[model samples]
Target chain A: MKVKVPKTLLTEHVALLERVIPTRSSNPLFTYLGLALTPDALVLFGTNGEVDLEVRLELPTEGEGRFLVPAQPFFQLVKSLPGDQVELGFGAELSLSSGSFSTRLSLAPDEGYPELFFPSLEGPAEPYPLQTLLPVEELLKALSHVRYAASNEEYRAIFRGVQLEFSEGGLRSVASDGYRLALYRLAKPQPFAKKVVVPARSVDEMVRVLKGMGEGEVALALGPGVLGLATSGSQGAAATGKGQLRMAVRLMEGEFPDYERVIPKEFPLKAAFDVEAFREALRRVSVLSDRQNHRVDLLFEERRVLLSAEGDYGKGQEEVPVRLEGLPLAVAYNARYLLEALSPLSGQAVLLLSGPTSPSLVRPGEAAEGYQAVVVPLRV
Target chain B: MKVKVPKTLLTEHVALLERVIPTRSSNPLFTYLGLALTPDALVLFGTNGEVDLEVRLELPTEGEGRFLVPAQPFFQLVKSLPGDQVELGFGAELSLSSGSFSTRLSLAPDEGYPELFFPSLEGPAEPYPLQTLLPVEELLKALSHVRYAASNEEYRAIFRGVQLEFSEGGLRSVASDGYRLALYRLAKPQPFAKKVVVPARSVDEMVRVLKGMGEGEVALALGPGVLGLATSGSQGAAATGKGQLRMAVRLMEGEFPDYERVIPKEFPLKAAFDVEAFREALRRVSVLSDRQNHRVDLLFEERRVLLSAEGDYGKGQEEVPVRLEGLPLAVAYNARYLLEALSPLSGQAVLLLSGPTSPSLVRPGEAAEGYQAVVVPLRV
Candidate 1:
């Protein structure tokens, strides 16, 4: 089989697919990118088993066939080619030529390559039972704001993912590492009420693809065991005027913890302070905090909050002026957790607390608007 | 001792000294920055055994004393301070306070810290036996052009450093790693004739310091077994108006190999091509080069250079247009060596080759100028 495509189009798609393709795999078949070519279009497939992605580029071509090439070398070759157009000829080895540059990449056996989740281009359109359309920016923003709180320990299973909860009220993105929980809400009713836990890695890959999405709404599909995101047109259009990108992530099979139980319903004490100033003070005072616990003490007083930490190295203290109300309080918390919780917030951050050891609530604005984080305080 | 200084001044000096201070040292004494306070200036010292550095920041103060603070934590603390001026009050602990931020850093015993080579503020100056002054820009430029070729293997001893040669004609910097050699010449004659080999790591620190140097000549001093670099005033002056920086590197204790033996004196064939075009073509063709030797075959044709490489993965080839003279030739070289040799050159590069297996000379311009590289070709 043979085909021709614009260099930029091929390079861009390969770059995106490279992110999902594992560099080293015990099974050699998993290291190859499947090239499925039809008479009028070429679909490139890449997968690391759990997460599969395919991108289609439309161009007038002569032949049709399916082949696999080692993804890494092929990716590097395409990026380094110095011509405006790339010609691919498949055989025992895949031959690629561009201007005065040419190379043949060794092909891998693809008989055992896993079938991708994307719908077949030639098959009858089997519409997903549930589908919704939403702005790509909103989805990406929601994911970025909460994914960092997901537990990185693989053994934690459900806690190592971001949970998407869809209800009549809106769609919520939630993640927790047991010690802290982050939630981002998008007030748009979905076509179906459902919940799914997507692995943190998949959420990261989704963010990468979403950033490259076009201005149009992205179609989201929720199949039995997989969640799909598809986008096409303007943003990454080829000169031939045809391009589409699709990503499917295998949903984690477990129930996320009942995170709402940890969020305090009411707070009698409130301390509002500049987010940037508070972050800086936390960073400074935490320098002398215990390396293992990273504990920094917060003493709420009239018009100011004093942060202090003492360790074998020495002692450190800093004061951040704040608008305090209700009553004075003293609390000890992991500085790292508070830092991460505050990272997604901007402007004045209001910390809602009830006691020294309660689950404290943190909101970006004067009132909780769309985003909030609950951090469990450590006993001093 | 008690003193106060501008935050920026202390931060900048600490950053520079941090480069020479090792984070983990078996002898804890080498991990601290010595703080020596005089009536008019505070001198900061840092050393990694082989390289010692000191910076003097002048400020009006009363007490005179010396103390040591763990370099890493102190560096971090200063960088995170949120005030304009930093105050230090010494006792059992080094008290540091800046506006609303304050901390105490545990002081290490200063009696065991290595004595710095910088001149004492109250003692009579003992001038270096050999001294030369040169523009910091010229010295930095010369070092940058050749230091990458230095051998990194500690067993190679003298070859793991940049050799500085001072003669009646001028100053020259040369380095080699057995496979290739690079030489850069500065035409300004020196005040004395000498030869010294400065380790590649020390050269890097010198480059860092030179970039921050004021617009004036830098004094080069050579004492027994040491190479000294000193610069002061204008660029890094404290608000109180006095500042000075000095660095000393222990010289490698062996004679540098006679590298002139490898530079071929005559060339029966020449291939001159655009440096950037050749670099890109080299990068492209080398993608399929053998992982072990990175060998890329170069075929000098009538008016172009054809580069090709074959490995287990595949084969790659590209042609770079060049102006050729003499007989056409064929040669194979480690693509990495040629690439590094070309990195320091711009515009047209002239390749002077005698045959396929001999050392090939690469010059930046049509005629040999101030820089050249000798890359030994692999017999393929």
Candidate 2:
């Protein structure tokens, strides 16, 4: 197989493939990337067993063939190649040449390369039971806000993922790590109700792929065991035209916790504080918080809220002015959780509390965005 | 003790101390920084057993006292504090107040804090046998060129240091890991000859200190077992004023190898190539070089050089145009070593070759810079 392609476009696509390719795997074949040339395009494939990614480049070719090469070294060679175009030829070995630079990469045996499922919009044998199209911006915004709260603990399968819930209202994303929960409502209603828990690791890769797709609506197909995302349009006006990217993730099989019941419906007390000032105070006070629990106390008052923390190292206190309503109250929270929950919000933030030990709700200045978070107070 | 200092000045000084203070140490006392308040200045002390650093900031104070605090936590608090002016007070605990933020840090047992010697210029009790002041730029340039060649192996006492040679000719810094050698001559003659080997780790800290010192001359004092570096004045006009920093590093004990003997004095062949082009070509070809030796072969012809490398992955080749002198030659060298040695040079780089298996010379386009490197060839 022989093909000549623009170096910049090739480098960009290879980098995307590199992100999904595992550096090492128990199945050694998984560490290799499949390079296949068809009559119309060159395709690159990468996977970590659970998630697979394919990037297609449309280029005029001499012959058609498929081969596998070590992902990392091939990436390095592609990035380091000089000039505007690179010619790839497969004969005795996979030969790559661009300007004065050329390399013969030893091909990994292709017999063991696993067949990957390619998701397409039009296909009679499509395995997906449900398919939906949503604005990339809205989906990305929701993922960014909720992804941070997902649990990283391996034993807690359901909590280690971001739950995508579809109902008559809209598509909502929820993530919780027991102590804290974050939920984002995208407001894109679906025809049928559905729920899927995507592993946090794969969610991160999906974010990367969606970002690279660039300013276009994404088509998401949901199956019993697999979730597929595909983008067919070019990146931009001057981008490599007609190239396509597709990604698939084996879904996590488990029931996500009933998070709706835990989200507080009523708050007897409400306090609005400048987000930047409150965040700064929390960071300073948390420096002295106990290492084990990272607990910081917040005492709500008439015109200000006092924050304090005491640990083996020392004790710290700071006061931030807040517009308050209802009776003054006090709460103790894991400072790290509160900090992370506050990180994705800006302008003014409202703290809605029910009692001392109950989960408190945090909302952005404008609740119309449908972004909310809940933090369970630590027992003193 | 009580004092009010500008937050920016305190932060800058604390950052310098943070560099020398070990995050964790077998001697627990070494993990704390000594905060001493004098009538004239506030002095901060940090040490890592082998190296010590002190930063002095002159500020008006209400009282004078010296205490010790956990270095890392205190640094974090100082960095996170708000406002421009910070008020520090010591009573039951160390109290720090900046704007609306305040913290009381529990002091580490000050009785156990080690006593560190502060080097000065006016004292007759000076223990240094030799003292010299050189332009910071010259010293920094020399250090950058030679530091990379120093061996990191802990057992190699002498090779794990950059040897400083002060003689009638000039102050020359040299380092070698046995396979390669790098030397930079400062051309500033000394009054009395002296030689010292500063450990590579200490050299790194010295670099940081020198860079922070900005535009000025650095004073170097050589004791029997310690090397002292001190810089006075401020960083710049719009910087912390009247602050001073001093650093002491315990010198490595051992006799350095005679590196001059390996530097080739005569060459039967010479090849001059564009530094940027040659470097790019080398980077591309080295992607397929053997993992262990990283060997890349150079075949010098009449007007160009061919570079090739083969390993388990595959083989790569590239051609770079060069002005050749004397007989055509072929030689191989570790790509990593050659790359590092060439990193400090630009414009046209001349390769002086003596033979296939002997140490070759690498010099910048204009050799007047007094920088030279010797890389031993790998046997093919």
Find the candidate with the highest lDDT and give its number.
2
Quality of model 1 by C-alpha lDDT: 0.85
True contacts kept of each: 0.87, 0.94
Tens-digit lDDT string for candidate 2 (B1-380): 79888888888878888888888999989989898898867888989988899888877777788889888779998887788888889887888899999889988668867777655654223676677788888888878889999998877769999998888899999999888899999888876688889888889988888888888887788777988877765533124554788888999887586767898999999999899999999988998999999999999999999999999899999999999999998899999999998989989898899899988999997878978899988997
Each prediction's DockQ against the real complex: 0.70, 0.81
Top model number, TM-score: 2
* Reference-based lDDT, each prediction: 0.85, 0.86
Binned by DockQ into CAPRI classes (incorrect, acceptable, medium, high), candidate 1 is medium
Give the deviation of candidate 1 from the true structure as CA RMSD: 3.2
**C-alpha positional error of residue A238 in candidate 1 after TM-score superposition, expressed in Å:** 2.0
Candidate 2 — which pairs collide? none
**Pairs that collide, model 1:** none
Pick the DockQ winner.
Answer: 2
lDDT of 1 by residue, A152-259 (tens): 886788999999988888889999988899999889988679999998999999999888774667877787878888775433245644468888899998768687
